[model samples]
Target chain A: MGKRFTLYTTIFLLIGIGLAPVLYMFIRSLFVDGGFSLRNYETLFQSDREWRLLFNSLSLAGATTLITVLLGVPLGTLFAKTDLPLKRFFTILFVIPLLVPSYILAIAWFYCLGRSGIVAMIFNADVGILTSNLLFGFAGTLFVMVSALLPVVIILTITYLRMVNPNLEEAAMLYGPWTTVLRKITIPLITPGIALAGLIVFILTLGEFGVPSFLRFDVYPVESFTQFSAFYNFNTATAAAIPLGLITLVVLIIERFFLRKKTFIFRTMGSEKKMLVVPLGKSKPFFMVAVSILVFILVIIPLCILIHKSVSISAYTEAFIRSIGSIMRSLVYASIGATCLVVFGFFLGYILARKAIRLFYAVDSIAIFLFALPGAVIGIGLSGLWNTPGTNFIYASMCIIIFGYIAQYTALGERIMAATFSHVPHSMEEAAQNVGAGWFRRLSGILIPLAKRGMVATWFIGFIFCLRDIGITMMVYPPAHDTLPVRIFTLMANSPEDVISAMCVIMIMITLLPLGGLGLVKRYIK
Target chain B: MVAKMIVKIDNVSKSYNKHSVIKAISLDIEKGERVVILGPSGCGKTTLLRIVAGFIHPNQGKVIIDGNVVADNGKCIIEPENRQVGMVFQDLALWPHMSNYKNLEFGLKAKKIPKMETRKRIDEIFEKVQMTQFKNVYPGELSGGQQQRIALARALVMQPKILLMDEPLSSLDADLSLTLRKEILRLQEELAITLIYVTHDREEAFSLASRIVVMESGKIQKTGTVSEITAYLSGL
Candidate 1:
C-alpha cells in the first residue's frame, strides 16, 4: 500500500510541476471578467504585424531547418564515411559547437560582422556577403542559427549513420555506381535518421529565442516579448504561444505518424557493421581545407573574440564587479535547476524502465511534449501563468526560471538515466529481494551505486545546459538580474566585443569544471 | 510421515495475455529437500520458479509457506522480501555496482541483524566462498566463476530457508559450471536448506537433484527421483 501510494505521489507531483505553467496559460487565456473566452487567441491573429510575425517565424524556422539539413547530411556522411586525416580531431571539432549556445554564436558572429566588426577592419573594405543586407533581418537571423545548429543536425545525423552498417555501403560498392550507392542504398537506410535530425532542428529553431531576438527580427518570440513588455498583456503573449504549441504539436504528430513503429525496430537491431572507409581520394584535401575554414570561421573565431571582449578594460569597474555577482547568482540558479531536473528525471526514468509501473508510455510522451516546446513558449506560458492573482508563491522568485530549466532539460536527464537503467537487469533487484534485502536497501546499496556514472552524467549535462541557456531565463528574469548568457546578451547591445568574449571564456570554463568532474567520477565509480 | 513442508504451491498457473504458460499445477517442497525442475526450452519451469521467488504472481491458486498463505487467488499476502528465499539468476545478476563485501552485507542489514553480526557473517561467507582475498573487488572486476561465488555468498548470508537457482550456471563455461554445480551441492548439504533449482540441462539436472520434475509446455510431464525420471525419459 505504501509503495502504491508513493507511485501516485510521484505521478501527481510530476504533472503538477510540469503542466502547471501550461495549465495556467490556459486559465489566464480564459480569465476574462470572471469567465472563459478565446478572445486572447483572437486578438493575437487579428493584426497585420501578428500575421507577418507568424510568417517570419515559420519561414525562419523552415529556412534554418532546410539550411541545416543541407550542411549537416553531407558533413555527417563525410564524417562517418571518409578516412579523412585527423578523424578523431575533426569529430571533436564537429561536436564542440553543440556545447556552445546559438545565441553566443549569434553575438560572436555579430561582433565580428557588425560595422565596427573585426572582419570589416581586417578587410579594410566590404568583405563577405554578411556586410551586405544578408546579416541584418530574416536572412541574417536564419543564417546565424543555421551555422550554429548545423552541428546539432550533424551530431544527430551521425548517430543515425553510426547505426547503419558501413557494410551496406560496402555491399553497394562492388556493383552499383557511387552516386547510385549514395542515392539508393545509403540514403534510404539513413532517411529516417535524416528525417529525425531535420524534425528536431525544425522544432528547436521554431522555439529559438536568442538568435532571432539579437538580430532584431520581429518573429513570434520578439513579438511575444513586445506584447509582454509594452502592454503587459499576458493573454496576447499566450495567444502567440498557442501557435508555437501548434507548430510543435504538428511536428510531433507528423513524426509519430511517419516514424513511430520504424524507430523501435531500427534502434533495437543496432548497426549492421563497422564502417568500410570510403576513401576520399582526390577530393580529400579540398574537402578538408574547405571544412576546416568553415569550422574556424563559424565556431572558433567567434569564441576567441568573446574571450577577448570579456577581459578588456572598460570605464565601469563596478559594473564589471557586479557582473561577477551576476555570474554567481546565475550559477546558483542553474545548479539548483540542474539538480531538480536530474532528480525528477532519474525518478521518471526509473519508472519507465521498470515496466511494472503502468502508464509508462503516457508519462514518457507528456515529458517529451514539454521538452519539445520552445523555451520561449514555456517562458511565455510560465510568465502568463504566474503573473495572475493568487500565484505569488513563485511569480517573481528564482523558482520560475528553475521550473523552465526543468521543463526544457528533464528529457535529456531521463534519456541518459533510462538508457543506463535498462542496461542493469530487473532480475538483479529481484535477486536482492529474494535474498531478504528490502526495496530501499536494494535500491540505495546496489542499483544507485551501480548507476553512479550515469547519475553524474545526467546532473552534469543538465547543469551545463542550464548554464548556457538564455532563451527561457531571459523571459523570467526579474529586473536588474543577470545570468551568464543574459549578461552576454546585454553585452551584445552595449559592451565591446572583447568584454563579451571574456564572459564567454568564463562561462565555458565554469561549465567545463563539472563536465570534467563527471568524467573523473565515472572513472572512480567504474 | 514426511518432514515439515517448507513451501507449498496449490494449483498455481500463469500466462502472458491469452497464452497460458503454466497450467494449473501443484507442488510442495519439504524442508532440506534438493529438487530440480528439468525441462525443454519454452516450458514453464522458469515461470514456476519465478512465481515461487515472488517475482511474478500466479494467475490462480495459492503459494503458502510455513503454514502462512503467502499468495492466493483471494489476495497475495506476502512480499518477496518477507518470503525469506534467496535466488541466483541464470545471468548470475551479481550487483555489479558493489564490492563483494557490500553485496554480502546487504541482505544482513535488510534483515536488521546487528552490525557486528552482519560483519561476522560476511567474513564467514567470504571465507566459505574462498572470496576473502577478493572481497573488495566489484563484480565487473571478477571472473565469471568468481562472480558466481560472490552471488552464492551474497544469497547465503541472508540465511534463507530456501535457495532458488534459475539456470545459475547456464552462462558459465563447462568447467566453471561443473565446479560451481559441485559447490552448490556441497553448500546445500552444509546449510541443510530446501532447494528449488530450474534448468534445461539434462546432465545438470541428473547430477544435482534428489528428485526431478520434468516439464513441457508449462505442465509437468513427470516427477520422481533422478533415476526414476531418467527411466521415464528413456522410455519416452
Candidate 2:
C-alpha cells in the first residue's frame, strides 16, 4: 500500500531476519547467571596465546594480501592493458579458483602433495613427505588463501585500469616510453583501487576459516569455530569472535568513510574501445611462456590430479549416492535463501542508490559489517539466539541455516544491485509518477524490467555464496541436514580420496551451471 | 619565402575491422603556423591528430616530423616520446593523482631534464598560465577552465617542435571557451610553435586557425586560408 509503510516493513523484516539475531546474541553474552557482565569479552587480548593467535590471524591476512596484490597487479595489467594472446582464456583460467571454494583447492593440494600422493608416486616418499609438511602449515595455508583471494585483486585492478582515461596515457607517452607512462600516470592513478583491493583481501583472509582450518593453521576464525564445535563453549567462541568483529568494524569504518565513495566511481568507470591496447611486441613470447608456466602450475596440475584421482564411474556414483540428499537440500535451501536475499537486497539497494532514507547508511553499514564478520561468528550467534526449545522450529529445522545465508550473503546482493540500480535513471520513475502510476506500478513497469538482468545476476551470486558457504552453515546445520559443502567437509576426513574428489568436482560443476545459465540469460536480456 | 614544413603525413590510412576511419588522408603542417582540422565527430580529425602525435600507427603511410621518419609502413620508427611533440587531449587527460605542478614536471623528468631546469620550467609555465597558486592542487580539485589552462600549460612547457590540441575547450562553458581560445591564440603567438588543433566547431577553427582543413568521412574536402575555407563552406 503506502511506500513508506511497505519499505519500513521490509526493512524491519530484514533487521529481524539478519541483524536481530546477532544483537540478541550479543545481549545474551552480556548476561551471566541473570547478571549483566563483560564476562564474554573480558579476555579479548588477555594471554600470550591470545596474542600469538592474533599475530597468526593478522600475519596470514597481511601475507595473503601482499602475495595476491603482487601477483594480481601484473596479471590484471596484462589482461587490461596489453595485447596478450588468449587474454580472455587466461583470465577465465585464473578465475577458476574463485569459482571453486578455497578449501576444496586446499584438499586438492593435499592429495597432490601428501605422503602417499602424486609426489611420492612420481618422485620419492621422502620428497612427498617434505612437500606434505610444507603443505600442512603456514606455507600451505598461505598458498591456498592467496590463490583463492587473488581474483579479487585482479578483478579490482582490471576494473580500476579501465577507469584510467586512455588519453592520460597517451599524453604521458609524449614525454617518455610506455614504462614511464605507466609509472608516471597509470599506476599512480589506480593506487586507490589497489588499496581497496588490499583492504578487501585482508578482511576476507582474516575472516576465512575454511582454508586455514583445512591446512591446520591456528587462526582466529578457526579458533572460534573450534571453541564452539570442539569445546561447546559459547563464551569463548563469542569472545574469540569479538576480536574479529572489532577488526571488521575498523575495516568497515575505513571502507565507508574513505573508500566507499571512491569505489562508487568504479561503477561508472570502465574502459571503452578508445582506450589504448598495449602491444607486447617481442616480449609477447616471454610473457606468454611465463603465464603458461604459472597456469600449468597453479590451475592445470591440481585439476588434472582431481580428474586423475576421481575419474572412476564408481567414485562419481558413490559420491552421488552418499551426498545426493545433501546436494538436493543445498540446491533448495540456496534457492530459497537467494530468493530471500534478492528481495531484501532489492529494497536495500534501492534505498542506497536513491538515498530514499537517511537510515540507508546505517542499514548499509550493518549489512556490510555482518557480511564481513566471520561466518563462524554469525553461525555461533545464530545458534546462541535461536537454539532454545521455544524456537526449535527455526533451530532444529534448516531455517537457521537459511537465516545465516541471508545474513552473511545479503551484502553481496545489496552492493551489486546498488551498482545496478545506480545505472537506472531516476527520471523514469518520476515520469511514471507524473502519469499517476503508483510505486508498485512504477517498480513493476519500469525499475524491475530495466533491472531484470542485474537481479538475475544478483540471485546467481547469492545462490553461489549460499551454496559454497561452510562457515555459517556448518555451525548452525541441524543433525542430518547438512548442505553439499558441509557434506563435502564432513566426508573429507573419513571418505575415500576418490569419493571426496568426486564430491568436490560435483560441487564445482554445480556452481558453474548457474554461471553458464546467467551468461545466456544476460546475452538475451538486452 | 615559402613556409617550411615541420610535419608531413604521406598517404596515411587507418581502418579498424574494415571500417575506414581515415582514408589515405595526407596533410603538411608548416613551422610556426596554426592548422585546424575541422569536422563533425567521427570524421577522423582527432585520429589524424593522434597519428601525427605518434600514438596510432597508420596502415600504409609515413609520418615525418622535422625531416625524421617518426612512423612509416604501419611501424613506429620513432616512439611518441622521441617525436618531440606535445598534446592537450579533448578531455584534458590531466594526470589526476598528481599535483598540477607534477603534471607539468612529468614530461621533463621523463626526458631526464635537469632537476633545476624542470623546476624553473614548471614555475615559468605555471606563472605564464597564471596558475602558480594551484601548483600543489590536483587536477580533480580544479575547475574546468582552470584545468584547461593547466592542460595547455602542460603541453606548452615542453617547448615542443609541434603542439596538438584536440578540442580542449569544448567541454567548458561558452565564456570560458572564448577566454581560453584567446589565451591559446596569445600563447601560439608568443611561443611560435607549429600547431595542429582539431575541432568540430567552425567558429573555433575560424578564431584559432591561420588555415582550416575541412574534412568529411575521413577525407579532407578543402584546405586553404580561413577566409577561403569560409567561402568554401558558404558555397557548400
Top TM-score prediction, candidate number: 1
Q: Cα RMSDs of all predictions? A: 3.1, 21.4
Q: Candidate 2: TM-score? A: 0.68
Instruction: Tell me the whole-model lDDT of each prediction, alpha carbons only.
Output: 0.79, 0.85
Report the lDDT tens digits of candidate 2 across residue range B1-236.
Answer: 99889999999999988999999988888999899999999999988998887667899888999999989989989766567787887777665546888777766765667999989989998988999999999988999999988988888888888888988888888898899999998888888888999999998999999999999998999999999999999998
CAPRI tier of model 2: incorrect
Chain A TM-score (model 1)? 0.90
DockQ of each: 0.72, 0.01
Model 2, which residues run further than 4 Å from truth?
A: A261-273, A521-526, B1-236
Interface RMSD after interface superposition, model 1 = 1.3
Where does model 1 sit among the CAPRI classes? medium
In Å, residue B119's CA in model 1 sits off its true spot by 3.4
Provide the clashing-pair count of each candidate structure.
11, 0
